[model samples]
Target: MKNILKYMSLAFVGGIIFASCEKSRPVVYTGENFVAFEDTLLSIPESSAKEDANGETQAIPSIATIRINRGSGDISKDLVVSYSVKAKYVTTDTLGNEVILGDVPEGNFYLSSPGAVTIKAGEGFAFITVTVVDNDQTDGNKKLTFTIESTSDASFTIGYPGPDKKAKSMVLYIEDDDCPLDINDFVGTLKVEDVAIVSTPLEHSYLVTSTQVSPNSISILGLFDPVTRYPSPTPCPAPVVLVFNTATKDVIFSPTTQTAYYRSGGCPATTNPRVVYPDPAVPNKFNTCQKLFTLNYYVRNPSASGPFDFVYSTVSKP
Candidate 1:
């Protein structure tokens, strides 16, 4: 009888321990619903450019489609997702380098609705349409961000945590497509104002004639005479050749780095004269509408450890 009683006590204690362990187990959530952007980043051009039959380029209005996906959700019921426009700012990295991201200004784009999308019943996705306004003047690229705020159903989660442990947000970059570059327009005599930024600034104004070398390249004759302090005439020993990047509208030196001028009687050899793009905070581009070039560059001599002189030049065609 004592043996049977001891066995019963052991069985009762085993049952209590099993119950305690069952209570301590973490609850697994397998039915959680999540809604997230189909794509984290998207790009929309300001206009659609296509080559015409006449071998000329034409521009058309552009539109973008943004999609939102519903994951592990009941398809029998409609899900309403609300979004909000979030302001994006330029930030710096650990090295203190600026991460260049410019926000889109108002009136540049239009959305289908103020801030919402609805996934219809029996559907797993919804879309939002965006139309861009064409800009006649040159402006740098801009970005817009939309964040999923909430869902109509309390059981649905907005976004799932990504590998970075941050919720997914939709980021759209708007490309500026204003005033396409035409090399023919730049062929002629252009008035230039070059200023050397030194302890004592030196300024010179002259005219340089540009000739088309290729479809997107131009060679300018007679840049400037450093010794005479005047505009060099045609048949200059060293002509400045520039290549234009039609997509980004950036003007670059053809050879990337070249000798602007040869050393005179006692002057050091001019080496590594190249165009330096402006800072991210400033606009650096060839203005097609204005027919102007605003550029910054540095001239280095063989004797100089770094750049010898920093110069800002504006070449405009009237």
Candidate 2:
């Protein structure tokens, strides 16, 4: 009986030994103990294109940019995006010409803080866009809607036709009197620079110079009035878009805004198209509808190239 018990004990020991001798598998740190990769994107800033009442048409100008990125834990990883434009006031046209959202990385990339764009005078109208180049297209609103209203007097303004294809610009505000609100309050005679006729190009252009008012501010410029239709019905059911008026050389905001319309193509030729108040003390940021110093340009129609200054700027008063 003793021998039999000893053999049983040996067998148990051998079994335990065999189990311990087997190869150890690798250990995995996971779940609550696991390290996590970064998630994509933080928040985007207030990118709404707000316009002050200046320039050809009210346009928001911006040169600054915001850097979108992942959290610190995921900063080392690569990121890509898909883009779309979300305009609260109106719908955006499908012109791929609005592509700065796509080509941003190519320009320059140093991690800058929240970027901003300032529309001095001739500078307004950027591709107010958002994109998720690396992610799915359904991430957010991809299309932007510009505010559009149907008025008899809708239009855009073009700058002086120049020697080079490049030209500075501003959008002309078409008066919209039919708009229910008081469009005339902002339509007082504007203070502008002196002018003479320059017909070397034979177009009988005006040689206009400029002036400016700092801290210029603007209130909403148009509203619709339909007092007669019915008390039950609302006025201006939708947004409106601007149109070009070659006949008047001015963009008429609406048919009712006939008298308040400004003439087109008559800004004084200034050596510095961007400077508004010709003050050496203020150095930069001249606030004028017409360019006070210098103006910048981007070619809209590459195929339709010529010695034409497509867009220009000049002084304007509210």
Candidate 3:
């Protein structure tokens, strides 16, 4: 009986092994061949201005490359893909409401050969190029949409899974590069409004004169003197300068270690306050179009103990 039991266990183990070794049917790709856009949304940066050899500043046009991809198909034969462009595209917002984004004007962009790209033999991808025209006028950012209309080879589908998929269309955002930094705009008289105060309260509204110190920097001559509780001299003994970032529109105090006086409780007499962004969530930036400065910073006396004061200020051009 013991020998019969041992043989039965061995037979069961062999049966399990045989079942595991048996191969299942292979997964066959029954879907048809298709072509689709590599990306649904794309951005083209604003054209930049460069000095030519003749000493003339010229605008360099921005180019955008749109890619088409082929899936599950023999790429040995050349395939011609045709696309259509529209001024606007219809999309849904977060609330599921339909939104139309067709802001691009007719003269803002030039498409090469009316949206046709050829996937060469033995290649699975092709590209179409669009040249963004720089009008040198600040008209805001624009958008254009392109849709895969048809193909020279009818055997391949318009989009990967189906023509109705998101890959069948692409949206191009052409950013504005027309706003060039002019240092003169930051010059003249400006008003500094203290929106939020920390430690000692400064003036509610103060007038300061700004002079262009450099191409991208300016000196504010009449900044409030924290020590004296009054406006500083015309030529400030401790110069207060603000530097502008041309690309990002960010403003920062050049000499970040400037000293100021605070007389509030738990604070020392003097403090070296550095310029910093008030909130990490929102950007500390200068609006060139509106000529506004939104800034946030802290004034802390290192010699003091406990909490320090946070200052929120806005400088605007009158």
Ordered by lDDT, highest first, the candidates read: 1, 3, 2
TM-score of candidate 1 relative to the true fold: 0.43
The sequence of per-residue lDDT tens digits that candidate 2 reaches over residues 242-303 is 12222222322222112111112333221211101112332222322231322111111123
Worst 10 residues of 1 by lDDT: 1-10
Q: What is the C-alpha lDDT profile of model 1 across 1-318, one tens digit per residue?
A: 000000000000010011234676743334557788878899877789788899898876567677777765356677788877643333335486656754433433333223777777767777766656665534455566778888888877778744452345788766766666788877888887888776678898878788999988888766654433544552223566888776667777766565555534323434333223233443336878667876566666555567656667888785
- Each candidate's root-mean-square deviation in Å? 22.4, 29.7, 20.6
Give the C-alpha miss distance for residue 56 in model 3, angstroms. 14
Q: What TM-score, computed on C-alpha atoms, does each candidate reach?
A: 0.43, 0.19, 0.42
Greater-lDDT candidate between 2 and 3: 3
Candidate achieving the largest TM-score: 1
- Ranked candidates, highest TM-score first: 1, 3, 2
Clashes of each: 0, 61, 1
Question: Please, what is the whole-model Cα lDDT of each candidate in the order they appear?
Answer: 0.62, 0.21, 0.60
> Candidate 2's error at 24, in angstroms?
23
